[model samples]
Target: MGCCTQKCQQISTFTIAAILLGVGISMAILWNNIFINIRNKQLSVAHDTQGFKMWKETPIPMYMEFYLFNWTNANEFMNNKWPTKPNFQECGPYTYSEHHIREQLTFNENDTITYKTRKIWKFLPEKSKGKLDDKITTINTILASVADTVKDKNIIVQEGINFFIKEKSEPFILTRTAEEFLFKGYDDPFIELAHKLHIKGLDIPFDKFGWFYDRNNSVDYDGVLNMYSGVEDINKLGRMHSWNYKSQLDYYPGECGRVRGTSGELWYPPLDNEVLEVFSPDICGTVKIRKNGTILHYGIKGNKYVAAPEIFDYTEPQNQCYLPKGVHLDNGVRSVQKCKFNAPAYVSFPHFYSADPSYYAGITGMKPDPAEHHFYLALEPITGLPLKVHAALQVNILLQNVKGIDVLKNVKSTYFPMLWFKQTAELTEELSSLGKLLLIMPSAGTYTAYGMIAFGALLLTIGFYLMFKKGWKTIHDEEQLLNQQQTFN
Candidate 1:
């Protein structure tokens, strides 16, 4: 009975150890192959998911830092010998706290959500290096835009525009405060006259002229966007379906016009792609950023994606479509004139970083620094959460001599630097702690699983050793008893 009980006890021990070992291995496999995917799905942007709430309105604090290129030598260039290079001085990083919210959400049955983005900005005087009242001298954008527009028209129209410019005595260089150059616009007589005359191809939207005039706190500025909610397909989360109900923009041709990419807010999780696309409503196009490297932020590992030189390279076959119609631009500059209502505006990296030398040939004080000018985003790979964002872009205007326009006849054709802005955001400490904890979970689970397997193996080994030793002892006892019985006989 005692032997039978001991044998049963050994069997139970082996069975329990086997079960534990099998369970540990199964858990490890499930964690890698199944549970991780399931977790990602649950975290995707669904109707009731945390991702949806976060996407509707970001919790992270965002800032817009505007750095204007103050044309320091505007007078010198205008009055000096013909073909004088314009000189610029980098001005204030006029800081503003930017708030974004997705309004008028309509969840569709096709697993998409349609909404309009409303952005409000408040100036942060403490964070700004220059005052809004600081005087800034720059090119007269109204005159330049009108000159460029009517240059191709009949000679009579060109003469009329020239006469109007002279009658108005529009200086080649206009002076305004930093505030007027930014959100608060200054009144331009040309805008008023164009509105009165109903000038063709010269329709100005607003009454005043400013870089971001009438844009602050405006809901209708950024049109409606329809994006995937990740309900049916988690990988497609936040991917834009259309902008303003159109899959393609009228601003560009071919693939450049296709409305594809995320809304620069969030992206799908488990990012395995080499490139990430972000659609900027401000630029009216998509920007593709390639993975540069990896980074560790606040103890969380993230993949860093930066705008490569090839994005703005017009010579590339794929980027040829980005070139404006009937306009040839250098490799670094992309003409957004069509999107900007024929203003001859171009977008590039700040200070023409990574741009062709020709862009800054007739301009001075342009020091392109990658550290300051590069556009980059760092995201956690698993959750697709942003760790750091530095979205920088420079706005340039094409300045060329127009026929019959006396003020611009001697002007050197140059892409004039207006201003650049850096929109930046980062995960807060509380969010960082949560992200670190979330990242630690996988390793902790893995270690726990392996530990269980090791412990189970140890138990199994001890059980086998004990059972062998007991059986051997019993066999030796029986043999000794048999030997004694034989001696007695």
Candidate 2:
């Protein structure tokens, strides 16, 4: 009875060890999966802060390099200086500016967060080229010339008054002593005329023209930049709405003028070759996906341009996102006719990446090169935050023939390129650490989990092998001794 009990005890011990081994291996794998999912959820939750969701309150600094087109020799086209119209040519680097964009988030009573941004623009005079100091004088002189020509033609005083913005019947120069101030409308004739035209039921194109100075002269901290971001469904990501121009005369859907979601959603883990469209409430259309690969940026090969959330809109205006009004809306050329920016000029991407081929086909002095002038952005896919964003845009003045102004009648109605800018924003060290945690740490954890599973399996196999050795060797030795005893007898 003792022997039989011993044998049954050994068998039970082996069975228990086998069950434990299976459970340990199974539990290790199950626990690994559970922990990995927990980590992902934790990562997602980390972005959810007190007021802002998926956004941090860190201050980001943006650097901008302005490249002004040298129109000094534009009239030389008539003189046959070279060939073709000299409206846009020889765009060279001009000046540099820095903007300290401060963003604040406030949670409203209705489960919504109000996002406010204040831009403190500082012009670096040391880095400026050409005639930065003389810009005010130049604009005033141009207005005066237009006014003089209009008067000579005996145009209506109403139109003449609107044509030439005058503080007191004389051209005014916009000047600012400080670099940063509250956002205000510029004292520009174009903007004033646009407003007047709108009241008269004429949808003429113009933006909020103003000098880069606050209306009060003294900085107004309460003057926060007002921009609204939609958040109807918290289940999905929310995108910023198009910025409304304070001086917008009338809404023109044909112009495709909204600017907030121009480059698509800030978040991306886009599918391959996905066509991403800009978000414009006016024009229902999509911007062509110029480049869909991640090779545009080094160290980031997973990011690609994809369709924005607005593409799913079912209505007419919400369905399409056209590029702009004047330029070919089929492509992605920017049209300032409806943008209503603070300037009396048009702004668009350099070389017009997705613009119509004809924009540069006939122009001799201008050629659009995507390799040299393409906008580049690198975003971390996991967090949907921009790792590095670089945008290059060209600013041009529309030179069209007015009916009464003799000086403008002979000129071609074209967007004359004035200047272009390359704005860049990079992630700081603090933000970069967050990205590393989101991207690197998860991968490391996965590898570690796999290693643990492999180790557990190895340990189980060793345990079973040792048990077999002990039991089989002992039985074999006893059988050998019994056979020896029988032979001896």
Candidate 3:
């Protein structure tokens, strides 16, 4: 009887051990599956006719609002002597009706996707703060005697014929061939003025003026232009089926100048002078990311390195922008003249975050408050998605010496701030939910696995302890004590 009982007890112990081993393995496998699935979701790319399509999950289609910098001191710029100080005031934060459609469309088996993007300008009428009569008067004065009949129409132009008007009317498109979309310059007013002069049989000699002569005369294309993202990764342009399962987070370099990096992930270590370089098609150059730790407390949040308001006061670098390299006539000017597109004027960040002291120093009526005008982007590290984005760029005309352009002759060599714009995007609840789910899953699984392992070990330990202490002796007692047997069992 003792021998039979010993064998049975051994069987029970082995059975329990086997069960625990299986359970531990199962939970570990389950945890792995959960983690992989979530990672795959972040790297998902739907194959479509357009090619491989990928974008931020939140906000459905990404939203972009542009705040244009209207030149408040236009009269002073045009009329004042050469090298006069130019004053630009922050104007309309015009909300674009269009949403971005990014597609890495494949044409062949090699997975070459022609990344074609298009933006439709909404026909919404823009609101202006004060009258820009000063700007209109300046423009009319410059084109004196050439188009006499059109001078009246140009002076009385209701809409300010400036960067704001150009953005409103221009079609935003990007293609591989174009690489970057080049502005057609402020040609709308000139076209209207020219047409009016033609009606009066006055053939205005536009060729005589250097500004009009060298200006882009080609009809502004409303369709998308063929452009390149300038990425070293050939896979970025397109990828094969083998690349499908791989990470598709970085489709293209961000449009917000170059400092955004090829990853388009702005999250960085919280350290001073931590510089990050990113590609920007607009600036036609690579830009460096300037770190100001005041944006947010940096760390992992929701399975990603995100700068949230709960972690900090506000989103990373709110309402702020950074200065670009002064490639144009110096003083931190970003000139497109040196670019392949040969753009006329210069471009830079508004308020000049890292600009040369001369850019704002001794300049009258210029308010460059770093706190207000700087650009910042709050990025989620793991997913490489920007929860909150702000990109600010200023367009300036490099006025020095041009023979035929009479207006530019009197103007001194200055990186005049023509206009600047801020592009912004913020996080929504839907995205936060997604992020939180991803953040919670691994922790929950880990804790659950640990608990199960501990419980299983405890059960095994207690069983062994009793088996070693009471062993066959307890069975022997129970068999002898028949009444006790029922209680023991």
Candidate 4:
């Protein structure tokens, strides 16, 4: 009928396809942008105190964490600078309580087996209202028995004292609950805490039996059969992928005493425990231990103005985990600024196509594994610092990634700065870009869908092309073949 008819039809088809692809590409770009905008609204990396579930609940000060080096150093520092009192003369100040005195005594009794000498402590006044108490007596974990003391304060001694009086006689030793040991000794001011510890009999003093291998320091030969080796729970004890890199104590090493927070179990307190409330790492509450033995405490506690909580809670080995001082509890999360380390450099995307090496998970909780993906960054403050098995994400990434490919990307490390210094960000980041996009309600989701139209367009375009490809090809081939046949005939 018309020469232009067939050509127009083919042109129309091409135009339609082009329009569809163009629309799709545009939508994809738009959706990506819209997703970004929508995400921004929902995202929150710069911690919004308002957005988080504020902890009107005050966390109790409990057992702290420590590093071996820090433990030795702090012990040495107190031993040298503050030097132990000659006798029980001055157990020092506020830090010393009946509980601490008891811990000191228990530690002394335990040390008696090692030091070849008896340890006596004298509590003399140093600083603060508590130490200033004339009736209050202080005890030292280091000093030998101090019978002679200033008349002002009591001579509180444990010479065949009732250290275990609170415990029943039948199971005198067995009565020592984790909470009791958690206090720092047979006598932490908070000895009552032992009952609170999730894992009972844990205070049994793994070392009581002597080093498992004496030479290797590695216990539990059977642990080697598991994916993780003889190391204690990385959560409770510390990382133990290898012997050299292992921490003195790790939590949840081989799923031994491992306990993870369930869906509603994640906890984060709002007010800084230190800034607003008084705290002690030596107490049991310093860490939120899962029943599984993952000791989740703070990564940094107090600010530069104050000292960090003793991480290892070094008062007594049986009750206290010997840790390093600088390795104090990152607990009592004062500020995220103090808890997190700025990334050395940001990596470019499609992280999948990334070629840069530094872009790898280093100190950040991100494990070095390629397949594993985690939201938190774990670093030893040192390279290859081990983590409690479930202490951090197996595959850790930067805690707060401003530029990341993860769908649940959150610039705000809401969970990092809080009490559960060990779990996934207490506040889960949904599909938010910076933590603001996809939401719980339908309106937000509908808007998300509308905002998602950009991507939808692309999907539609792709679908159209895939679906119509054969039909379009058939039309072209038939037209061409018909023309060729006509010419030949």
Give residue 90's lDDT in candidate 4 (0 to 100): 17
Cand. 3 Cα-lDDT: 0.41
The number of the candidate with the highest TM-score is 1
Query: For residue 222, what is the lDDT in candidate 1?
Result: 86
Clashing pairs in 1: none
lDDT (10s digit) by residue, model 2, range 364-396: 445666655666555555444566666565655
- In the range 163-194, model 1's lDDT, one tens digit per residue, is 88889887778889999999999998899988
Best by lDDT: 1
Off by over 4 Å in 3: 1-17, 22-41, 44-87, 107-113, 120-260, 263-276, 290-331, 338-341, 361-363, 403-405, 469-489
**Over 4 Å off, model 4:** 1-4, 38-175, 179-489
For candidate 2, the TM-score is: 0.61
The global C-alpha lDDT for each of the candidates, from Candidate 1 onward, is: 0.86, 0.43, 0.41, 0.23
- Per-residue lDDT of 289-391 in model 4, one digit per residue for the tens? 2121112223321111111122212342321332222333222111111111111111111111112233322212212333221122221111112121112
**For candidate 3, lDDT tens digit of each residue in 1-489?**
433566677667657766775676577678877784545444433343111233311233343333333444554543445434555455444444434554434334432233334333331335323222212111221232222223234433323323323544421110111001112123334445545545442343332222212223222211212222212222232112222222221221233222223323222222232344444544444455554443332233321221111211112242112222332223445445433122245555565545666666634445665644565655444444445566566665443433333343454444445445555555566756665566567778877777767767777776677777765444666677897777789
| Native-referenced Cα lDDT, model 4 | 0.23
Cα misplacement distance, residue 350 of candidate 3 (Å) = 0.3
Better of 3 and 4 by TM-score: 3
Residue ranges of candidate 1 with Cα displaced over 4 Å: 1-25, 77-83, 270-272, 454-489
Using lDDT as the yardstick, the better of models 1 and 3 is 1
